[model samples]
Target: MTLSPAVDAWAEEEPGAATDRSGWPGGIPSRVVRPRAVIEVQQLLAEAYRTRTPVIPRGAGSGLAAGAVGVEGAILLDLSALDRILELDADEQLARVEPGVITADLDAAASAHGLMYAPDPGSVGISTIGGNIATNAGGLRGAKYGVTRDHVLALDVVLADGSLVRVGRDTIKGVTGYDLVSLFTGSEGTLGVVVGATVRLIPRPARTATAAAYFADIATAARAVTAITRSGVRPAVLEILDGRTLAAIDDLEGTALRERGDALVVIQTDGYGAEEELEVLTSAIAALATDVQTATDAAASDALLFARRRALPALEALGRVLIEDIAVPRKRLAEAVDGISDIAQEEGVDIFVFGHAGDGNLHPIIVTERGAADDPVPDAAASAAERIFALALELGGTITAEHGVGRLKKEWALRELGPEVHALQWRLKEAFDSRGILNPGSSL
Candidate 1:
């Protein structure tokens, strides 16, 4: 491959850059280029566009959806070198950053100014801000703080044809034209490469109260969640884990969580009225839970939150895991949990349930016997996933809550989106990249 002198950047042909955290086996790309400047990105995109070559934009590559998996004969654009917090205006309560800025780094920086970046996905520590925007990523705080899209104020994107266009305003509120900021936010790099972003931040909470409740089963824990939500106390974080998940965590961490109960509900209330909110939440949860434990200090609070964070890793220790994300109406959360349990039993597969129960976004992970990393996912697990997706739709929810439909879920996404909407989305992509480049074969 040849490049113009104006676009001075090193290209790596190594196979390591061709893969991401997604188990999808991506073909070796022609080259992986890390551009240090916006002009270099534009130049590279322009050259790729002229040659009609596929260009895949990538950040920290922590995505679960294989959205950044490299394709054969493609140019993998690694944007990690562009990590720079260009501006942090405490008065304006916003920060402007390059695409490679780590999400946690930004949050820490904001915290110094008594503010916080609220879109904390599970991969926040390692995931980049640009990647978060790509999926509109959500975390435990989503029920209260919203997702990446809620914080993003503007984006500087480089179109497939190499045009640099800035969409959205820096101010808090604006509706001058079409909401392109939102349109491109969750487009999953299919529309364009996000070179930079301006994201809003809010004042950090003064205090937080954390608590954990144990229930006889997941369904009961889910009911407690519903009760808490209806009790008029909005928690900063609300998460749930099933019996299998709790046992796995206990085995891995040497904790006796399973002995206490078959299910766990972790809640955190924040801001000035955090204690008062906790009083209400504890009262509601205690009515349904067999046991309740409240944190007495910051360390204890983190210890309680650790269980939710370790749920996936704990399950991974048991065997190969196929994690699924889905969301249903909050009122029907218990129904969804029961339906998942039924699916697992019918399929004769081990499906561990956990997720942001407050918002109905559940992660029903299917575990199979240990196998090679490259081995295909079991057919039974795939069938169970389809059934779960159907269940979510049947309950007036979505096939996906936060994770974008990368190559892994594109077919199911098309079914959920319907043919007419899918056609319009394709046309929209054409309007942005007529050559059909830019993260081809992924995210619609």
Candidate 2:
């Protein structure tokens, strides 16, 4: 298992080498390899290919799904050491960066030029660009600017056999060939490892407005979301939090949010007409909301957004959490939330619902009593999660919105994709990696 000199190796005993943020323990790998350059990655992969050894690609291990989990007798390829911003072209409105560059770092770098990298997942501060691309990660601004796939202009990928090839063009518009750039963007490392990427950036919004609307329940808040969506205001961030989530946050942060209402909608509008958009957003939801509060300054705006961002952490503070991501059609968003409440009651578990309401992506987090760090998910929680997935599919939505299927949602993903499309996907996987050495059995 000798790797290139440019690659750093760690024995299986090294802490945190075999798992990811999913809190699932992937079997200990034979070793962990951190490659500093593309050639190093290529060399390591070539050897792994020749030996038919499994290789799992990982960024910062911030993935919620088990996408980056290591396998027994496999090689864990860590790309964090390759962190670098290769180029930032303001005139072209694009930036070329190594896969390991943190998502927030790129946005910060772009901000200096009055531009921003739009795909800001919740883990932006810790997650890498490569990982975001792998999952097609979405975030608060997803309703407006879209996700990782929308921002990615091109990619430098190391194929399963250790060949380096580029996909996509640097230009904004291209239809010369198959959309391989997209194919690889959300492939979850089953196809290839992203070594470097050229991503598109957008100008930073000149103005911004924020507002918080409280409602009696999440379903009601969801109805308000539908109204805002239909109003044609196009808010930059539209998020919702349920009663349980509000209570949890209040308990953890000593905030009186739960006292105000059982559910909340936090909205932020940006760009030159941000103030005008905010007015439309508030007006659309005013009648339905128990109370509506708008921010008058930047500090007040961040204060409103902070609670929405803290939803996950507050839930985590209560106990072990199984965070699930599902998206339904915007019109059915309220139905989806109501169905989830029903599922929670039937399963006798506490499920806190929240997410990017503007785009119909919901995070229904199932919380259980705290136990061992590696404890298996309880049967009730698992059953509740399965039903949630079924509901998402029943409502013409997906089992996963931003989180890649990885190892967690494979069964449901199969049900969602159906046999014919699943077979076609397998054929595509076979075409890319015949030996099945690249993150095998982790995604697709």
Best by lDDT: 2
The residue ranges of model 2 lying beyond 4 angstroms of the native Cα positions read: 1-6
Model 2 scores worst on lDDT over the 10 consecutive residues at 3-12
lDDT of each: 0.89, 0.91
Model 1 / residue 325 / CA error / Å: 0.8
Give the C-alpha lDDT of model 1. 0.89
Kindly provide the TM-score of model 2 when superposed on the true structure, using C-alpha atoms. Answer: 0.98
lDDT by residue for model 1 over 23-73, one digit each (tens)?
777777787788888988888899999999999898998887788987888
Question: How far in Å is the alpha carbon of 38 misplaced in model 1?
Answer: 0.9
lDDT accuracy of residue 290 in candidate 1: 88
Q: Which lDDT tens digits does candidate 2 get at residues 80-199?
A: 988999999999999999999999999999999999999879999999999999999999999888888999989999999999999999999999989999999889999999999999
Give the per-residue Cα lDDT of candidate 1 at 385. Answer: 89
> Which candidate number has the best TM-score?
2
